[model samples]
Target chain A: MSDIPADLRYTKSHEWVRTEEDGSLTIGITAHAQELLGDLVFVETPEIGAVFAPGDDCTVVESVKAASDVYCPVSGEVTEINEALEDSPQIINEDAYGAGWLFKLQPSDAPEMDELMDADAYQAHVDEEDH
Target chain B: MGNKTPLYAAHVEFDGKMVDFGGWDMPLHYGSQVDEHHVVRQDAGMFDVSHMTVVDLRGAGAKAFLSNLLANDIARLKDAGKAMYSCMLQDDGGVIDDLIVYYMTDDWYRMVVNAATRVKDMAWINKQSAAFDVEVTERPELAMIAVQGPSARERAVPLLPEDLREPSSALKPFFAAENGEWFVGRTGYTGEDGFEVVMPEASAASFWKALFDAGVKPCGLGARDTLRLEAGMNLYGSDMDETISPLEAGLNWTVAWEPAERDFIGRKAIEAQKAEGKARKFVGLILQGRGVIRNHQAVNVGDETGEVTSGGFSPTLQASIAFARVPATIGDECTVDIRGKGVPAKVVRPPFVRNGKSCID
Candidate 1:
C-alpha cells in the first residue's frame, strides 16, 4: 500500500497538495504514483510564473520504463519549481511526499481545493486502480 | 492469466514486481532495475530464462537440415559442443527469429530461441524438417538460468556436480558441455563472461536457491534488456520482426555467402538485395543532450527520416543511446525528435560497452 497523508488533498490523477501558510498550495505526486512509475530518471518541471487550468499537463516524470505527465489539480499560477529534481530525480522515488514536492502554486480559485479528494477518498481511488 | 515459469515462486519470494512478459508472468524488476543492471555489469547476477524455447534436432540428416534452415552456415560448427548464432528466415528474406544452435553431437543439435516466437518458430522448423528426416522436439521440461558478470563463473562453478566442474570451467566461449542432465554453455547476453545452464525443471528451484545463497543477485527482464542493449545485442520484437531482414538489422556478419551452390531459406531474396546495394544502414546513437531516447522515436539523418528501434538511458555510460535504421548515406551527425523537440545525437558503431568497460571513445 502507498502512503497517503491525512492532512493533504489529492486528485484522481495522483498529485497531492498541501496548503502553505501564505495560502499558496504545495503540490507533488503521491507515493502511489511514484511506486507505479518505478525509478525516476528524469523530471521536467513547469516554468515558474506560468498559469495553468485544472487538468493541464504541467510536468513530466520519466522512468526507465516510460514517461508520465503530471497534471495540474486546479487553476493556478506556478510560484516555484523543484530545482532539486534537475540533478536528483530519484528523490521522488525515495521520498515522494516530503522533499520530492514538484512545485508550489498560488491558486486562482481557492474553492477548487475543496472539490479535491481527501486521503481516504484518494486511498479508495488507488485501490480501484490496483484491481 | 499469463503462464508462470518454474521459478515463479522464487521470484515472488524475492519481492519481484511481476508483469506479463510475452504471455508469461515474470519479474520486471526485483526492487530497483538500475541496481540489478549494475550488479550484472559490476559483479554477478542471475536471471531465470526458463521461458525461452529449447528445441533438440536429432537425425542422420540434422547437419544438412540446419545448413539449409539458418542464415548462418551451421557447417562451421564442426566440433561437438560448438555454437553458432543465426537468424531463421522466411522465404521473403524477413527474419523468423534469431537463435543459437549448439552442435552437441553428430546426430543432435540443441537450439534456444526467443520465448515470444515459440509457436511460429516451431511451426516453421517442423515444416522444414519433413524432407530431412530430422525430429523436432521441444523440451518444455527443461529450465534455463543465465549467470552473468565478471565473477559469475567463480560463484556458480562450486554448485555444479563434481565430475562436470573441470570441463565446465575450462569451456571456451561459445561452447557447451553436457554431463548427465546438465548442459552448461560459456555464453551470455550481458557482454560478460559467464555460463548459461540448462537443466531439468524439477531441480531449478534448488539451483536458484543455491546460487542466491552464493550471492548471485536475482535480476529481472528490465535489467536483461538494458544489459543487452548496452552490449549492442538486438531484441527480436523491438529491433526486428517478421518484416525486417538481417541485412537491414546489422546482422550481415552472421550470414555466410560462400559455396554459392548451397542454398538456405530466404537466400534468394537476400542475394538480390545484396546485389542491389540499397539496403538501409543500422547504426547506434548517443544522445548529445538531455532526455531519454525511447523506441519508435523519429530520427532525422540529413534529409531523410528514420526510426529508433531499441533505445534507453545506458547506466554504464550515463547517457541516452539507441539503435536507428537510417538511409545508407547517413552521416555521423543526426537529430532525434523527443516530445516534438529535436535533440542532437552522434552516430557510432555499437557495442557501447563490453566486459565492464565503455566501448565508445
Candidate 2:
C-alpha cells in the first residue's frame, strides 16, 4: 500500500502523470511499480523531442534482479527527463514520484488526461493486480 | 504458500519479499539486494540455504559407489572431513546435478545437492545404489545456513557449540568439522571467507536470530545470485543440466582426468567429446556498451552464435557480467544481442570478482 496522491492521474500500466501549470505533463512510475521492481541498477529514459503514441514503451528500468518497461500513457512529445537518474538510478527506489520522475511531455492531445484513471481507480487497479 | 523452510517465519518477520523458487516460497530480498550483496562482500551476511538437499551415505561400498557416480574423482578426498565439488552425470555424459560431497570416514560421506534436482538425483542415486551395498538417506530434518564475508568467521565463532567453537573458527577452506548433529564447513559460493553451518531444523530460527543479533545481515536469493555470479560459480539448472556436459559449462577443471583406469560415469562420452575438439567453451562476458546482460541472450562471434547461460549486473564491478557458452573459436570480442539490437561486449575469463576485489582489468 504505497502512497497514491489524489491529485495525480494514472494509467493501468502504472505510470502516474501530474499536470504542470505550463500545460506540460510530468510522468513517472508509481510507487507501487518501484516497489515491485526492487532496487534499480540502471534507468534508460526516452530522449527529449521524441514523439510517442499512448502505450508505447518509453523507459526501461533495470533492477538488480530484472528489467522492466515503462509505457508512455499519453500521446506527447518528450520535453524533459530526469537526468539525475542516469548515474543514480537508486533515486527511483528512494522517491519514486518526486525526484525520480522519468520524463516530462508536451501533450499533443488534451483529452488523454480524461481517459486516464483517477487515483482511487488506479489504487483499485493495483489491488486487483496484487490479488 | 509453498514449501516452507524452518526460517520462513523469520523471513516474514524481517520483511523479506517472498517469491516461488522451484516450488519453494523463498525470499528474493530483505529490502535492497545490492545492499545485501555489499554487506556480504565487506562484512558479514547470512543466508538460509536450507532448501538444498542434504544426504548421508554409509556402507562398505560407499567410496567405490561415489567414485563411479560423480564426474570428479572422489578418491582424491582421502583425508577425513575433506570436501569436493562435483557433478553427477547421466550415463549419456550430460550433467544430472552439481553437488558438494564431504568425506567423514571410510564408510560415511555427506552430500549437498541442488533443491530443484532433488527428486531426480535421489532416484538416480537410489537406482545406482542397488548394485552396491550403500544405503542412501536424505537428511530432510537438517537446515543449512551460510555465513559469508571477510568477517563471517569471526562473528559466527562465538555462537558455535562450546567444544567445537575453536576448531570451527580455525577450519580450513574446503573442509568440514562435526559436533554431534551440527556440521560446519569452510566453503561457500560467494567467493569469500565463510562458514556454511548445518544444524538440526528445530534450531534454525534461533541460530538465525543469534546471527542477526551479531550484526550479520540477512540476505536472500537475489543477493546470493549476484554474489555467486561475480564469483564465477554456476547455478545448477542455468549453467548446466541433464542435456549439457560439464566440459561445456566452465567446469572442466572439476573433472579429474588422471588415474586413467578409474572409470566414472560419462567418462567415455566426455573423453569422446574432448577428442573431437568441437566442444563449446564457457566464458564470462562484460558488457562494453549500455544495457544489462540477461540469461538466454544471443552472443554473436563472427557468424557463430552462442547462448548466455547465466547473466546479471555485478554490484562489485558496477557493470554487467554473464556466463556465456560460446564456440571454441570465439575471440576476445563478441556482440551480445540485447533486446533487438546487437550490443558489443568483451570476453574475459569467468570470475569478475573474488575476496572483495575485482578480478577483471
Candidate 3:
C-alpha cells in the first residue's frame, strides 16, 4: 500500500493536499491516480497566478494511453507550479505525496478542507470504487 | 462476470487494476505502467498474453490451405521450426487480421491471431479449408506467456526443463520448437529479445509462478502498447481494420507475391490497387515541439490531410511519436493537431526506438 500521511486530505478524483504554515496548500496527485495513469508523458498545469473555482480543471496529466484533467479540490489562486516535473514527470509515480506535488495555491478558504475526505474515508472510497 | 486468465487471481493479489479487454477481465497495470515498460526495456518482464487465441491447423493439406487463405505464401517456411508473419485478408484486399503462422510440420501449422478477430478468423479459415482438407482446431485449453527484454533470454533459458534447453537455446528469431507439451518461440511484439511460451492450461499457473519466482516482473496491457509502438509493430484494430488495407497500414512487406501463378484470396484486388496506385503511405512522425500525440488526430501535409493510427509519448525518446497514414504525396514535414493547435513534426520511418537505442537520426 502507498503511504498516506494522516495530515493530508484527499479529493474523490485522487488529489492530495497538505496545508502549509502560511495557510497556502500544496497539491499533488494521489498514489492511486499515478498508478491508474501508468507512465506520465506530459503535464499541463495552470499559470502561477491563475485563479480557479471549485472543481475547475487546474491541471492535466497525460500517460501513454490516455490524458486526464486534474480538478481543483477547492477554489484557489495558483502560487507555484512544480518546476522539476518539466524534465522529470515520472516523479509523480515515485513520490506522489511529497516531491511529486504539482502546485501550491492560496486557498480562498481553508474551511473547504472540511468537505474533503480523511485517510479512512478516502481508503473506503477507493475500496468502493474497486468493485 | 467476465473471463479471466490463469493469472487473474495473481493480478488481484498484486493489486492489478483490472479492466474489460475484449470480453476478458485482464490487468491494465500493476500499480505502475511506466515502471513495467522500463522493466521490459532494462531487464526482463512477463505479460499474460493468454487472451490471444492459439489455433492448431492440421491435416494433409494444411500448407496448401494456408497458402491460399493467407496473403503470405506458407511454402517459404520449409524448415520445421520456422515462422512467418502474415495477414489474413478479405476479398476486397482489406486486412482482416495480422497473425503469425508457425510451421511445426507439413501436416500442422499453428496460428496465433488477435483476440477480437478470433471468431471471424475461425469461420473464414474453416470455410476456406473445406476444399484443401485442413482442420482448424482452437486451443482454448492453452495459455501463453510472453517474456521479453534485453536480458530475457538469459533469464528464461535457465528456467526451462533440462530436456528442452539445447533445442530451445538453438532456436533462432521467429522460430519455435516443442519439447513435449511446451512450445517456445523466439518471436515477440516488443523490440527486444525474448520467448513466447505456450503450455497446457493446467500447467500455466505453475509455469507463470516459476517465472515469477525466477524474477520476471509481471506486466500488463499498458506497457505492451508502448513497447509495440516503439518497436513499429501495429495493433490490428487501431492500425488496420476491415476498412483498411494492409498495403496502406505499413504491412505490405508481410505479403508475399512469389510463384507468379499462385493466387491468394486478395491477390487480384491488391494487384488492381497496385495498378491504380496506393493512395496513402504510412509513416512515423516525431513531434518537433512540446505536446502529446494521440490516435485519430489530424496530420496536415500541405494540401492533403492524414490521420494518426497509433501515437503516444515514447518514454525512451522522451518525445512524442506517431504512426500516421497520409497521402502518398505527403512529404517529410507535417503538422499534428494537438488539442486545438497544430504542432510541427518530422516524418521518419518507424521503429522510433529499437533495442533500447534511438532510431531517429
Candidate 4:
C-alpha cells in the first residue's frame, strides 16, 4: 500500500484532505492517483473562495495520455490555491501529499471529516484494488 | 499465455506505472512522462524493449527465404552484421509487420519484430521457412534495452564488457557486433543515436541498474510514442494494421521493386493498386492554434474528410502535431475537428522535432 499518513482523511476519488489544527483542510491528490496518471503535464485547480458542494467537479488533472476530473469530497469554500504548480506541475507527481497540495479549504462542516476514509481503511481500499 | 520480459521485476521495483501494451506488462512511465521525454531529447534514457521478439533464421536458403518473404531484398546484405529494415506483407499486400533483418552470416539471419505481432509473425515465418529448409528460433533467453538520446552512446559504450568494448564502440549506425551471446546494435525507435543491446536475461537487471546509475533516465512507452511520432515513424497498429497497406501509411519507400522476377508475397496486389491509385495518403499536420490535437480527430479538407491516426503535443516543438490519413489528392491546408469545432492546420512533412530541436521554423 502507498504511504497513507494517519492524520489525513481520503476520498474514494483518490484525494487526501488533511485537517489542520486551525480547522482548515489542505487537499491534494493521493499517491495512487498520481502513480496511475503517470507524469502530469497540466493541472486545473478550483478557484480560491469558490464554494463547492460535495461530489462536485472542482478540478482537472491531465497527464500526457489521459485526463481525470478531481471531485470535491466535502462542501467547502476554497481559501487558497497552490500557485507553485503553474510553473512546476511535476511537483504534484513528485510529492502528491505535501508540496503538491492543490488547495486549502474552510470546511462548511468540520464533522464531514468523519465520513472520509481513515488511513487503515484507505490502505485496505487501495490494496483491494490491486487485483 | 503471453510472455513477460526479464525486466518485469525491475519495472515494479522502480514503481513504474504499468500498462498492458500489445499483451505484455510494460512500463508506461516511471513518474513524469514529460520529464522522461526531455531526458531523452536533452540527455540519455533507456527503455525495456525485450518484449520485442528476436528470432534467428538459419539454413543454406536463409537469404533466399527472406528475399521472398520480405518486401526488401536481403541479398544486398553483403557484409555480415549489416541490418535491413523491411515490411512483411500478406498475399493481398496488407502489412503483416515491419521488422529488421540482421545478416549475421550466409546461413544465419536475425529478425526482430514488434512485440504485439510475435505469434502471428512466428507462425507465418515458420510456414514460409518450410519451403527453404530454414529454421526459425525465438531467442527468449535474451533481454533487450534501448539506450537513446544525443548522449546515449557515450553512456552505454563504457558499460559494455571488455571483450565487446572495441568492436561495439566501433559499430556504425544500423550495424551490430556479436560478441559471444551479447548482441549490440546501433539502433533505436526514438529518433536519436543509440544502441539496442540484447544480452543474456540473467545479466539484464544488473546492466539496467548500471545504466540507471550512469544517469540514463528510465522512460516508458509514453515517451517512446511521442518520440517516435515526432520523428515521423509509424506505430504498427495505429498507423497501419492487418487491414491497412503500407502504401497508404507512408511506408511505400520501404518496398523494393527490383529483381522484377523475384515476386514477394504482396507484390501483385500492391502493383495492381499502384496502377489504379490508392485512395488515402498519410501526412503530417501542425496545429495552427492552441488546442492539443489527438487521435481520431476528424480532418476537414473541403469535400474530403479523414481521421487522425496519431496525435500528441511535441515536446521539442512546443506545438501540437499529428499524422492523418486523408484523400490522396488533398493539399497543404485543412482543419481538424476537435470537440465539435474545426481547428486550422498546415500540412507538413514529419520529423516535427529532430535531435531535441524543432524540425519546423
Candidate 5:
C-alpha cells in the first residue's frame, strides 16, 4: 500500500488536500495515484488564477504510452502550480506528497475537507480497489 | 490469468508488472519503462519473445511456396541462414501479417510471425500450403528471447551452443545461424545491434537467468513498444492490418515488384492500386512542443485529413513522435488534433532514432 499521512485528507479520485495556515489549500495527487501511473513524462498543470469545481480535471499527467487527468478535490482558484513538474514530471513518481504537490488553491468551501476521506478510510478504500 | 509464456515465472521473480496483451499475460515492465528503455538504448536488455509464433516449413516446395505466399521474393535469399522480412498479403492486397522468414535450405524454411495473429496465420498457412508439397509445422514448444543493445551480442554469444557460437556471433543483420534447437538471429525491432535467440521452451527460464546474471536487464512489452516506436518500426495490427495494404503503409521496399514473372497473392490488386494512383502515404510525425502524441489522432495535412496509426513519447528523442497515413500530397507540416487542440508536427521520414542516436534534429 502507498503512504497515507494521517494529517492530510484524500478524495476517492485520489487527490490529497491539506489546508494551509492562511486557510488556502495545498492539493496534489496521492502517492497511490502516482504508482498507478508509472514514470510521468509530461505534466500539464492548470493555469494560474483559473477557477475549478470539485472533481474538475485540473492537471494532465502523462507517461509515454498513456495520459491521465488529475482531478481537483475542492472548488477553488489555482493560486499556484508546481513549476518543477514542467521540465521534470518524474518528481511525482519520486515524491507525490512533497515537492510533487500539483497546485495551491484558495478553497471556496472549507467544509469540503470533512467530506473527503481520512487516512484510515482512504487506506481502506485503496485496499478495496486492489481486490 | 491468460496464456503464460515459459518465462512467466522468471518475469514475476524479476518484478514484472503482468498485463494481458492480446490473449497472453505478459510483462508490461519490471519497474520503470523509461528506465528500461534507457538501459536498452545505452547498455543491454533482454525480452522474452517466446509468445511470438514460430513456424517451420519443410519439403522440396518450401522456397517456391514462400515466393508465392509472401509479397517479397524469397528468391533473394540465395544463401542459407539469410532472413527476409515480408508481408503476407490477402488476395485483395491487404496485409495478412508481416513476418520474417529465414531460408535454412531449399527444403526447410523457418518463419516467425506475430503472436496475436497465430490462429489465423496457422489456418491461412495450412489452407495455402495444401496445393504445394510444403509441410507447415507450428513450433509452440520453442521459446524466443531478444537480447538487444550495442554490447548485447557479446554478452549472449558466450551462452549459445559452442559449435554455433563463433558463426552466430558474426552473423550479419537479417541473418540467423542455428544448431540443434537453437536459432540465433542477428536482428531486432529496437533499432539496435543485437541477437534474437530461439531455444527450447523448457530451457527458457534458465537462459533468461544466465542473461540476467550477465547484466542484461529484463525489459517488458511497455519498453518494447516505446523502443520500437522510437526506432520507427511498424507494428502489425497498429501500423498495418488486414484492411491496409503494405504499399499504403510505407513498405514499398518490402514488396519485390521486379521480375514480372514472379506472381504473388496480392500482386494484381497491388498493381491495380498503383495504376489508379492517389494512394495514401505513410510518414513519421514529430511534435513541435509539449504534450504526448497518441494513436488515432486526426492529422490535418493541409486540406486533407489523415490519422495517426501509431504514436507515443519517444524517450530517446525527448519529444512525442508518431506515424500517420496521410494523403500523397502531404507536405512538411501537419497538425495533429490532440484533445481538441491542433498540435503542430513535422512530417519526416520514419526511423526517429537509430543506433543509440537521434536521427532527427
Candidate 6:
C-alpha cells in the first residue's frame, strides 16, 4: 500500500495539499503518484507568484518512462517553489510529502480544502485505479 | 495480465515492477531503470529474455531454405557456431522481422526472433519451409538469459558446468557453443562483452538465482531498451516493420547482395529501390533541449517532414536521443516536435555509445 497520511488532503489527480498553521498551503504529488511514475529525472516546478485555478496543470515531472503534468488541487498563488528539485528531482521519489513538496500557495478560497479527498478517500481512489 | 515467462516468479520475488509487454508479463524494472542501464554499461547485468521465440530448423535443405527466407545470406555462416544478424523480409522488401541465425551444424540452424512477432513469424517460416524439406520446430521449452557488461563473462563463466566453462570463455563474439542442454552464445544487444545463454525452461529460475547471488543485477525491459538505443541497435517493431524496408531502417549492411545468382525473398524490390535512389534516410538525433522525445514525433527536415521511430533519454549520454526517418535531402540539423513546440536537434552517425563509451563528440 502507498503512504497516505491522514493529515493531508488529496485530489483525484494525485496531488496532496497540507494546510499550514499560517493559513498558507503546501502542495506536492502523493507517494502513489510518484510510485507509478517510477524514478523522477526532471522536474519543472510552477513559478513563484504565479496564479493557478483549481485543476490547472501547474508543473511537469518527467521519469525515465514518460513525462506527466502535475495538477493544482486548489485555486492559489504560488508563494514559493521547491528550487532544490531543479538540481535533483529524485528527491520527489525519496520524500514525496516532505522535502519533495513542489510549492507553497496562498489560497484564494480556504474553503476549497473541503472539496479535496481525505486520506481514506484518496486510498480508495488509488485502489480503484489499480483494479 | 498476460502470458508469463519462466522467470515470472523470480522477477516478482526480486521486486521487479511487472508490466505487459508483447503479450508477456515481464519486468519493466527492479527499482530504477537508469540504475539498471548503468549496471549493464559499467558492471554486469542480466535479463530474462525467454519470451523471445527460438526456432530450430533441421534438415538437409536448411541452408538452402534460409538463403531464400532471410535477406542476409546464411551461406556466410560457414564455420559451425557462427551467427548472422538478418532481416526476414517480405517480397516487397519490407521487413517481416529482424533475427539472429546461428549455424550449429551441417543440418541444424537456430533462430531467435522478437517476442511480439511469434505467431506471424512461425506461420511465415512454416509456409516457406514446406518446399525445402526442412523441419521448423519452435523451442518453447527453452529459456534465454542475456548476461552483459565488460565483466559479464568473468562473472558468468564460474556458474556454468565444469567442462563447458573453458569453451564458453573462449567463444568469440557472434559465436555459440553447446554444453549439455545449454546453448551459450557470445552476443548481446547492449554492445557490451557478454553471453546469451539458452537453457531448458525448468532450470531458468535456479540459474537466475545463481546469477543474482553472483552479483549480476537483474535488469528489465526498460533498461534493455535504453542500453540497446545507446548502442545504436535497431528495435524490431519500432525501427522497422511490414511497411518499412531494411534499406530505410539502417540495416542495409545486413543484406547480402553477393553471388548475383542468389535470389532472396525481397531481393527484387530492394534492387529496384537501390536503383531508384528515392529511399528515405534513417539517422540518429541528439536533442538540444530539456524535454524527452518520444515515438511518432514529427521531425521537420528541410522542406519535408519525417517521423521519429524511437526516442528517449540516454542515461549514458545524459541527453535525449532518437532515431528518425527523414527525406534523403535532410542535412545535419532538424527540428523535432516536442508537444507543440519545435525543438532543434543535431544529426549524427549512430552507435551513439559503444563499449560503454560515447561515440559522439
Give the interface RMSD of each candidate: 0.7, 0.8, 1.5, 2.5, 1.0, 1.2
Residue-level lDDT of model 5, residues A1-131, one tens digit each, is 68899999999888999988899998888899888888789998999999999888989989865889889898989999899999989898899889999999999887877999999999999999999
- lDDT scores of the candidates, listed in order: 0.93, 0.93, 0.88, 0.88, 0.91, 0.93
What candidate 4 gets wrong by more than 4 Å, as runs, is A1-10, A15-28, A43-60, A72-88, A94-127, B339-341
Clashes of 2: 0
DockQ of 4: 0.35
Per residue, candidate 5 scores C-alpha lDDT tens digits across B1-361 of 7999999999888889899987998999988999999999999999999999999999999888998999999999998899999999999999999999999888999999999999999999999999999999999999999999988998999988798789987799989999868999999989999999999998888989999999999999989999998898999999999999988898888999987899999999998998898459999999997899899989997888999999898889888999999988998998999888998999999898999999987
**Model 2 chain B: lowest-lDDT 10 consecutive positions:** B272-281
Rank candidates, TM-score, best first. Answer: 2, 5, 1, 6, 3, 4
Quote the lDDT for B33 in model 2.
96
Model 1 vs. true fold: TM: 0.98
- Between candidates 3 and 5, which one is better according to TM-score? 5
Off by over 4 Å in 1: none
User: What is chain B's TM-score across the candidates, in the order shown?
Assistant: 0.99, 0.99, 0.98, 0.97, 0.99, 0.99
Candidate 3 backbone collisions, by pair: none
Candidate 6 lDDT over residue span B163-196, tens digit each = 7799998899999998648889999999899999
- State the TM-score, rounded to 2 decimals, of chain A in model 3: 0.96
| A48-116 per-residue lDDT for model 3 (tens digits) | 999988788898898777889898998889999998888888888888998889999999987898999
Encode model 3's per-residue lDDT on B54-110: one tens digit a residue.
999999989889989889999899999899999988999998889998999889899
TM-score, every prediction: 0.98, 0.99, 0.93, 0.85, 0.98, 0.97
Native-to-model Cα distance after best TM-score fit, residue B208 in candidate 6, in Å = 0.6
Docking quality tier of model 2: medium
Worst 10 residues of 6 chain A by lDDT: A38-47
The CA lDDT at B271 in model 5 is 88
